[model samples]
Target: MIQKKAYRFLLFLILQSCTQAQTFNKAKLDSFFVALNKNDQSMGNIAISANGVLVYQNAIGFSQINKGAKTPATIDTKYRVGSITKMFTAVMIFQLIDEGKLSFETPLARYFPQLPNASKINIREMLDHRSGLHNFTSDSLYSTYMGSLSLKLK
Candidate 1:
């Protein structure tokens, strides 16, 4: 078993090293930015990266419309990204499951025992947004505390 694993590892490394990496031109990217500016695009940002390299980023318009502050789109730009990050998290979690290190039926409470119905929820269900965790980010009272992020669908 160990020998087979080592052989597979070596083959993976060889394939990785044998591949040619792709490159892009800054001038072409700058032209796109110029067009964006020409259109007076407001409050917009874009991020592009490949193989751990930051290939493109541009933030145009105002970060704060009231104060009129400009922020250039860059990889470091805090765009919230929202569910996109969640997508990546889901992919990594799926990969773990694929490798047999994780499972779909694992209870959510295993990690967050504080949940009222942790035993009923699972990571797989959470990834699918079907864990029945109630959203509590909205309320007139607890809204200040729990907001609307309920572990179980209310």
Candidate 2:
């Protein structure tokens, strides 16, 4: 009799846990993010998933603020990642190097032979910012180029 009662209690506890996990308080989550947005604490999208299924998704704040005009951020917003790309590139390059698929001494020409002096540029030089490559984004025509339909390099 005691064994049967214990088994029933265990089953009840398992069911209760599953119900609580599946029926998450979405309103509470939204309110928390809304408070953050109102307080200017965060300005980006967040997505949560469970068992390969998305559970919660939200976006907050402005994507762009130019001359006091704001563009409300959305889940589809594309933010310029900027220097963060350098970090990701470095990490991936290091991984490849560690796996023996690449080396710091690899010449850039192997991948970008069209670039000027690519044969002289090594992975180490590029990673160390000593490759002598021109900063295209710093040029006067950069904005115009960005506004153009084709962003491809000549």
Q: Report RMSD (Å) for each prediction in the order shown.
A: 13.3, 11.9
Candidate 2 clashing pairs, residues 3+ apart or interchain: none
Instruction: Please give the lDDT score for candidate 2.
Output: 0.79
Q: lDDT per prediction?
A: 0.62, 0.79
lDDT score for residue 55 of model 1:
61
Error of 1 at 8 (Å): 37
| Candidate 1 local Cα displacement, residue 93, angstroms | 1.4
What digit string (tens of lDDT, one per residue) describes model 1 on residues 1-154? 6654564475355334434335555565556456545655434566556677666666665433335565444434444344688889999989989999889998888789998799999988899888777765444676444424332212
Clash totals for all models, in order? 18, 0
- Give the number of the best model, judged by lDDT: 2
Error of 2 at 140 (Å): 2.4
Q: If scored against the real structure, what TM-score would every candidate get?
A: 0.54, 0.77
Tens-place lDDT digits, model 2, residues 85-105: 999999999999999999999
